[model samples]
Target: MPTAKRPPKPPPKPYHHGNLRETLLVAADAVLAERGAQGLTLRDVAKAAGVSHAAPYHHFASLNDLLAAVAERAFGLLAQALEQAATEPDTAERMLKINDAYVACALARPAQFRLMFGPLLARKHDYPEFKVAAERAFGVVLTAACAHDPERGPELALTGWSLAHGLSNLLIDGALEGLPIPVGPGEGLARQLAVRALGVTGAAA
Candidate 1:
């Protein structure tokens, strides 16, 4: 005798406790990780989220809006990581650790990292929340840099951030796989630079 048909699966709820907005953001982040920014769209996010195509519209006005929200979430997470990384009392060592945290956070969420810096979203200036989150994340680094040198804090922060960002991308893309030096987030040249910036040298470095 033929077996009876299996029961149908339940449809996804439109929102869980009025959290479709967060649900959409989570779905968008997953889609971006799985398929990159080019593949992130409201319909796709809805499909991934197991929600109706119209569900995303109820939360995000447009793809750019969703993208900004996703980026904003990433920046918030990065800021938290940076804040926690400054635990060591030694300021120079703390700076390096913060840089390492920044790199590690990027490596942990490479897709989000790219989205945070990519041009797909409308200029961050147009998105107040996005701008605040980005600045707050950057402020962590700036705070450390300014403490290292009040006269040149902004420039130093940019230099350090640029180094960490480039290093993260290189590692994420597998470009640093064969380097002869022992690889690390902020152990070598990055550490040296951090120490030098604070005028720490030799054994202290």
Candidate 2:
């Protein structure tokens, strides 16, 4: 006689995380990593989280909402990296360290970095949390710059930030490869460029 058909597998147990909001955020990050912001979507995030497509809607209203959350986390991490570099007492060294940290963060998570600064997610008014986190991260550089030059703190901060941001984009976009600099490690080359361009001295190799 033919064996009876096997019972259907349980419906995936409805994918449960202790905190669904946080679960969605984690899943969103993974999706952002594999696919840039343009490719990210609420349905995709929900699928990655192993929940129904509607599940993400419970935590996020739209793709922008999810992106804002992910960008907030990215800014927080960038802030921590800058803060760690701020521990250096020397002004030039501190600035260089902060710049290096910024570049390192970009290199470590290019997709997340791009999402953090991308036009869609950078709308400060629309995403207060993203704005706040970004401001806090920027404050690290501001503080370092002020410590270096009391007379031109704001200007110095702007300059430092511009340089770092430009370098990060170039590195991420693979534009640095066209430079005439010797073919050293990417991070080393990046750090060297930041130090030299910023006139920072006493930076560790």
Candidate 3:
């Protein structure tokens, strides 16, 4: 008599269904928020996602790939926020909205923020998609800046970007609060002064 054999069991899936890429990115984001890029690892993310250690490889070949994905998501969100901010009527008002939007986005998503702007993941040039996404996000601010200063559009865009980038960096690093600028309802006094220096007038008198 011959014995019958049973088929092998199917492999288990990752914790989340339908969107493993997003799950890995979310796990990576949590690692970034808590331990930063240096401390992040594919194994750690896999563990966080309750998947096999090699499961991440199905979506991201290496840690940098996962990181680039994180950056791409961040840039998309930033572009949307800035675009919305720039929609305000007055140029100054629009600029102010953009300024606030940048900082708010960073604060709201610190992990994504660090990945987008922090030096820890400084190999941005190596990732073309990440670079393109970054440029898209920056273009939002540049457009608003140009709209505010048509005569010197390019320079104005750079100036506004510098000011907003520097301010966002400072706020993220806790340096803005220590600045000597006035606070409270006059919270944006420094930003107003900087915009004026770039020849962009504030809202109507």
Candidate 4:
């Protein structure tokens, strides 16, 4: 008598989310918001995205890869926010708007902003997309600064970036509250500081 053997199960049907990459990115963002960068994991992202634990591997080789993607997206958003300031007819106003946008973006997404600028993710060479997006965002500021002062454009751009970045970190860490600035709210205070940093008083009128 010969024993009958059952056929092997089909390879578990490779979990298919219609837009898995975007889904994973969205899931990663949510995880970042709730758990911060240290708590993020491919498994957690997959679970959040409603997919198999191994699904993230299809799009990301490692946790860093996933984080890099998230950073890239954050930079793109920051670039868009900065670009909005370019719409102002006046260069000084535009620079001020750009500074405002930088702080606003960081405040709006503290976790993402931290991850984007954190030391652990400092290896820009490892993430070309992130590098490109970051450069584009910086370029917006540089362009606006150049418009404000052609001779000091490059120097002013760096200064403005440093100022905005410092303010963002301060605000996010709650260090700005202790400062002796007479402002009604955190946003207003940030705007005022940003304007002064850029030396853009034209918009003040």
Name the candidate that leads on lDDT.
4
Runs in model 3 lying further than 4 Å from the true structure = 1-16, 119-125, 176-190
Minimal lDDT window, size 10, model 3: 182-191
User: On residues 19-80, what C-alpha lDDT tens digit does candidate 1 reach at each position?
Assistant: 88888888899999999898567899998888888888887889988999999999999999
Candidate 4 lDDT over 88-107, as tens digits, reads: 88888788778878988999
- What lDDT tens digits, residue by residue, belong to model 2 across residues 33-81? 8888886789898888888888887878888888888989999999999
Q: lDDT per prediction?
A: 0.81, 0.84, 0.75, 0.85
Better of 1 and 3 by TM-score: 1
Per residue, candidate 3 scores C-alpha lDDT tens digits across 17-112 of: 578888888888888788877778999999988777988998898988888888888898898898997889898778767776776777677667
Residue runs of model 1 more than 4 Å from their true location after superposition = 1-17, 120-122, 179-205
Which residue pairs does candidate 4 place in steric collision?
Answer: none
What is the overall TM-score of model 4 with all chains considered together?
0.88
Residue 15 displacement in candidate 2 (angstroms): 7.0
Best by TM-score: 4
Candidate 1 to truth, TM: 0.82
**Can you give the lDDT of residue 80 in candidate 3?**
89
- TM-score for each candidate, following the candidate numbering: 0.82, 0.87, 0.80, 0.88
Give candidate 2 regions above 4 Å deviation.
Answer: 1-16, 178-183, 203-205
Candidate 2: worst 10 consecutive residues by lDDT? 196-205
Report the Cα lDDT for residue 92, model 2.
Answer: 83
Task: For residue 98, give model 1's deviation from the true position in Å.
Answer: 0.7
Model 3, backbone clash pairs (residues 3+ apart or across chains), number: 0
